[model samples]
Target: MSETKISKLFTELNQLKWSVVSKGVIVGLFAGFVVALYRLGIEFATEKSIEIYEFLKHNQEYIIVWIVVIVVVGLLIAWLIKCSPESKGSGIPQVEGVVLMGMKMRSFFIIPVRFIAGILSAFFGVSLGREGPSIQIGACGGDIIASKLSHNKLEENYLITAGASAGLAAAFNAPLSGIIFALEEIHRSFSPNILLAATTAALTADVVSKTIFGLKPVLSYVDIPALPLSQYGWLLLLGILTGVVGALVNKFVLVSSKVYDVLPAWSRPMVALLLALPFGLFLPQVLGGGQNLVQLSETAQMTVGVLFVVFIAKLFFTTSSFGSGIPGGIFMPILSMGAIVGSIFAQTLSGFGIPASSIAILCICSMAGVMAGSVKAPITSILLMAEMTGSLVHLLPVAAVAFIALLTSDLLGIHPIYEVLLERLVDKDHVNKKHDNIVLEIVVEMGSDVAGKKVSEVNWPTGTLIAGIRRGQKEYVPNGDFIIYHGDYLIVLSSEHELETMNTCLNKLCRKN
Candidate 1:
């Protein structure tokens, strides 16, 4: 190429790079403030919820008023769901659907709806977490900004991803985990553009969160001692136990919807609130997102029997509450359950002369293990747990447990929770929709039906056109003689009438042979 041509090309590339970085800053700042506000709201709601319960406990006459309040909160949640169905449940799957599939969300309505519903649901003592809603809110902020500033769909996707990472970072004060999650789980690639945007946004958001919530870790563990090599065996055993329990948790959560499907739409959320009354009055420790339960386990205040009971109650309640299609997340609840499991395991070993300090280590490791097994994001889980505890002294144990739990879940043929949830959402919302012209992106899995096949050999669905194929950082137009390889991202275009049929065919074509 000529010198002038090369210079012009480099100039354009530099401009694009700076443009994306600038946009990332804007997204990070906006999403950071929004999520920070969300965090404050959640804190207020949680404190008020406990205060109300305490008041009722002291005054028997006010019990009726509490019941009336719960019923009203339930109706309001049900109404919110009715008005914005997309805001129901943990917002992670919805964000994933938007990024992976070509699904669209009405950000203006979803943001406020999710914020209000999430706070109210938790305020009424529902077993939900605030992180999920914060993520959705951040993504919506990114989308709104990108929609107004940029015209390219590809650029918009990057901003949305950056927003998601920023949201998670602000929610938990874990910037690295947020960036890794965006790349590993959300984008499923290590593209340079995504890396740059995610890093910038996550760090910026972390700063904003720290400014408001201080520099302390979200779940602080003071002076956590490292485990000895001799005690590593126990971590493996704990991993296996957490793996089994994690699989069960995923299974129950998936079927919770089916269990509640028989109920009227408006009454679904109400059932969870009504059931919460008994637990709220009797065993309030298992209420909300179970943060207090984690504190109790960490301090070893609860006996083994009491820990087991709390675990069982939390497991059942979380599944039921989530199944009601309320605006909440299982992220914190799952971690809390893992803490209980670890406590029980440690207590069982204490009979055999295990040190209490080592048991505390197991509690932390098991939290990472169960999160890895259920979410199938081992790196994110490990980093998140470490960051939350403000210690990397247990990376080896954490990694070992996380790997084992992830393997066990895979052996059981279980999909990641978010993946399953996204599939269900798509099945319900997109299977019957018709579009004028739509583009679909499919990653060619190893051993997929079309892997290693020439363009002429594979039978593609009718009325669909292969627009392009992306391999590594390059894009190419395929010809009859071109061969498709595994890991290639195929961009297919179809008419409105053939959208659903094309989607099914493409999904099958992308599945493992």
Candidate 2:
């Protein structure tokens, strides 16, 4: 209790914090290397697959061979998912389960299975992104290290989050977004420990990625001029459009999952793969992750009509591919669709006296808007777009659009895409329930039901206990009199048996009414 004693205690705690972050850096380094390798593998497989498609296009005689190859690849992907169910889909939900729901994943099995299956899915032209798999791979790497070196569950979770941060950072070469995403979306809190660890991990992983992929932004659009104040009205309109589209995309993704559920597990991928055949042969621009499609749109290679066709095709293909429960991600696919939407919107307004350069700016801003609407992470969307485009000149416009899109989506009562997916996965009990003690960190969104309520006012679940509350740099042991505000993080502790009920109650309390 003395001044010297308190100073010594603070110093020790600071040292301890840095030590954990140091471990995170080490985990991040390993995760970065693994994700880099995964990226290279996917790139190689994608190139080879495209080459095969080109060759087959020229030689109709080999069409039968290509069909057989796709079927076999489909079967292989199905088998991989069967062997390691944890590797299914984007793996982001599973990571969320691990960190928040006390879900367990077999790192040894999931790591390789996801890597191989993800590459194969991409190779076969499944409309998927590499970012999700990279995140899972990074999380697995962290899990492996934590299991070997740390026995504490809290520390292990931090490492897992760190790995996920590293994964996204390495995948997109956006360290800041990666860090913000891990906090704003994954952890859903601003814990000092999590921030430090995630930052170290993301930066370290970015270093590894840049060493191999160079220092260029992921989606480079140089010389993007800032939108004038007069054009602000158009940006708002674009935001509303993207918000509606994002909600529809979210609905279709869930609906597609249900549609695919009727089929036998092994047949789902086969059907989706077969569905890809026609598009692959006729409209290859919408294939794979569709990054090139976005680049093409940016260069105005496609007219409005053609952009619409490609958008519909990519949207449906992405929904189907994800619904089939393959080892893939919707991150890039969603972004690609957003780009197409932006292009179409820009082209439509070109006759209204909007300059070509302004159209391009609208296209760029809409991408962020759609992302924010769908993912419900406006900060991440804005920062990610800024990093991807390598220009912050349009930050105000991007932020405005992202905020509007998020508001629109919320008004429509559409849950964030990942949150919905996580719910589905959790309902199926994909997570291992061996751990009885579970800790959940829930963020209070600005307009959430509990945002301005006192601790005692909210109808918390019977068995749930508020372990602590964190608001910015301050922490508190919540009492009945304590008032919770927007941006405060509630640390709730509950048993596994009570998790579902607790989550239901928490959702009602936290979600925007």
Candidate 3:
């Protein structure tokens, strides 16, 4: 993993730009169709679940029969997890462990297990979202496709990322947000080639989904006036409130998973299914990833008290569903919760002289805030809000709210939900496992500690070596007296198992303060 070796590796990739990009397009196409069908299936299941609940409400004699059916379905889900353990819970963490931590991904096993179990979970009124399952299906299937078409592992990884981008785009019909999420949340790199592939895949996949579903925002609210500048104070308060709530959600989600660990693996899903039974009888609105609840918020006349109750029920249901190791995500549930919080806040401030039309806009703003606080991806949150709404008029307020919420969560020492989950996944094997050598290219920023220092003067991380430095058109192998200048790309090599340590060390030295 020397500079010359790294250069040679990338040079080979540069020469096959068309090959790589075309592979990306192929993955995108595959991801688009598959994830679209996945979305279609979930939508159908959700509708059927509601109808059945409605029917059961009238047919009291058949309630016991329905309960028996639910138990059987729960057992079936447990067997599905037994068939594919990696398919359990949110698949994002498993995918991350594959690309980042060298964990194995059963490309073939995930698609079927997740698809079937996800549909079953939704049809049974689990408060879990489809976005995570869609991404997993896309990534695993993308990896399968890329493995056959690509000549190298690097190319395969790039195509997988592209496929993941496609999946998110198809799920939400937000192409730009998908690309940004790929870069900001998944890859965590800004290489031009990665950007080129992700953009092409995301846009094309979005086209396919739009063709099937039409070009409408994934979620919609009644037309509302944009917030006036004088109402900035309210945005400030909303940001802090959503931030606190989001951090607490991260904590609860983790705790919920741990609580389920006490049960044997085969019986976990059964517990959650039984828990959801009561809600299906009385609070069906708070089920199935909160889609029903959000629709209720938009069209129903609701009080703050009602919203509070709904929020609590939705939170509990989501945690239980996910904790039982259901193959789903918190993406929609979090947004739904944020919307509830927003509506409650707006109603409480009815006497603040806020315009009647502007009341509905707060829900969207609070969504961005809570997403930033929970996911810790502020740029992704901002773009997702914009693309999902198809309106740029609210960008300023959303950005303000998102950044403030992000800051509040940072101050509270709350980690991002995905990162926390990833740690729990990797920590068990990380203790003694050895990994292959990996090279990382990081930029030197103006405010970085090493910006103006000599290479020998800075203390690098343990088990790491500076492989090379690229400044402008010139490349230099680092020597003790070599100066580290701003905007230089430093190529550092470290063992894969040591990446977390190296990244922590490098960020303090190379990233802007």
Candidate 4:
């Protein structure tokens, strides 16, 4: 290597490094402001929701009035979905789809729409969480910034991740955990760029949020004794239980959604409304995000029976409300519900001579396990839980449960929640917009025309190209004379308009699915 070449490389590297830092700093500052606004929006929504709940609680004499309020809530969510369908559901999958689907469709209008709709939904006792929506809102902010900046694909990905990190950080007041959430759950990658961007975004958002609201753990903890070493086996057992339970929760949530799809669209909201009505009668605590239950569980204030009832009620309502297509998140609700179940399991096992503190330890571990299994992001699950509860000391137990729960869910063959949801959403969108474009994978079969034909010979559509081909286990950028062969897989990047024109031509030349 000549000194001239070495110096040139160093100069390019320095330029790239500086570019990343500059973009990250700008994204972080913008993301911080967006996160702070998002936090205030959630707080405002929650207070309004509590006010409505209290009003309804005291005005139970007029069943008609309660029905009107419930109907209004349902109608409001329906309007949001109808106006901007992207605002539906947790918004986590939408964010993932935007980043992964190679689709540059940015619904900038969705940010404020979702923020308002989500608050209304939760405030009116819809069983949902805010964290997922917060992630989507944050990502939207990042996406807008990325679009304005002149950057390559990789840099855009980094900026999007930074915004997502800030959103979670502001929502939970957990900066480090937010960074991990973006890395472990969203990007599934670790690098210097990601680390710097995620850390900066999270810290910046935390600073902004703390300036408005004091720095406090999301869940305030009481001084509780740590479990003895002798209870490690119990922790393992709880881990296994949480795994199974988490698997069941995921299964039921999916199944319930499918069931809702089979019902008439008009009846979906009605059914959810009815499902929630019963909670008003006997289990009002289960009607919302269950933040009250979370505080109670942490404080050891819930009785065994109360825990059991709350757990069951929460499980049913969360599944029902989410499955019905009401736009909301399940993040906090799942955590609160898992805590209830864990507490009950621990207290029950305590009768078998295990100490109460040990049972409580099992409860905490179980909560982490169920969260990990359900989300299929064990590292994020464990770290987020630790930060939210201010309990890094329980990392060992939490990690054990998280791993076991993840393994159990995998063995049960349940897909990750967001992936499955994305599949359904995309499928439905495809049917609705039958003319929409799709990324299709095609292979050259032995007897197909393209098997022996060169890329130049095939009547390829405009705006379409053979982006890449995998031939005999080797991948290559396909050029005009790239020899097409049997068993070679071709990735076609095209729009539906182009695809329609090329369909018959390609079918004669190759296999398409």
Per-model tally of clashing residue pairs = 0, 0, 0, 3
TM-score of each: 0.89, 0.90, 0.91, 0.79
lDDT of 2 at 416: 87
TM-score for candidate 4: 0.79
> What RMSD does each model have against the real structure?
4.0, 3.7, 2.8, 7.9
The segments of candidate 3 whose C-alpha lies over 4 angstroms from its true place after superposition are 1-7, 16-18, 298-300, 428-439, 443-451, 461-467, 470-476, 485-487, 492-513
3 or 4, greater by TM-score: 3
1-513 per-residue lDDT for model 4 (tens digits): 344653453344235445656666666667667756766766666556556656666777765776777677777667767777777788877766554454343447777678667666655566887778777777777777777983554556667777788788877888887899887766644545667877877887788777767778776656656767777777667777787878878887898899998987656766687677667655677767767777677556778887877787788889998898776788888788778877777777777767766555565677778888788888888887678667778888888888988888888887778778877877787212224454344557777767877888877656666656756535666678878887876656556455434544554567432
Model 1 TM-score, 2 decimals: 0.89
Find the number of clashing residue pairs for candidate 2. Answer: 0
lDDT of 3 at 410: 94
lDDT of 1 by residue, 1-513 (tens): 344653453344335445667888888898899999988888788778787777777787988887787778888889988888878888888888766664677789888888888888777687878777778888888789888987655567778888999989998899999899897777665656677888888888899899989999888775778888878878778888888888988999988888887898888888988887777777889888877877778778899999988898999889999999898889889999988988888888987766888766788888888888899999999999889878788899988999999998889888899899888888778312323465455678888899999988999888778877778766667788899999887867667576656877887887684
Which window of 10 residues has the lowest lDDT sum in candidate 3? 428-437
Could you give the candidate ranking by lDDT, starting with the highest?
2, 1, 3, 4
- The lDDT of each candidate is 0.81, 0.83, 0.80, 0.71
Per-residue C-alpha lDDT of model 2 across residues 272-304, encoded as one tens digit per residue: 888877777788898888788778776677999
- lDDT score, residue 283, model 3? 84
Model 2 reaches what TM-score against the true structure?
Answer: 0.90
> lDDT value for candidate 3?
0.80
> What digit string (tens of lDDT, one per residue) describes model 3 on residues 71-171?
78888999998788778888877776665554667778889998899988878778889887777787876688877886665566667778888889999
Q: Please state the error at residue 184 of candidate 3 in Å.
A: 1.4
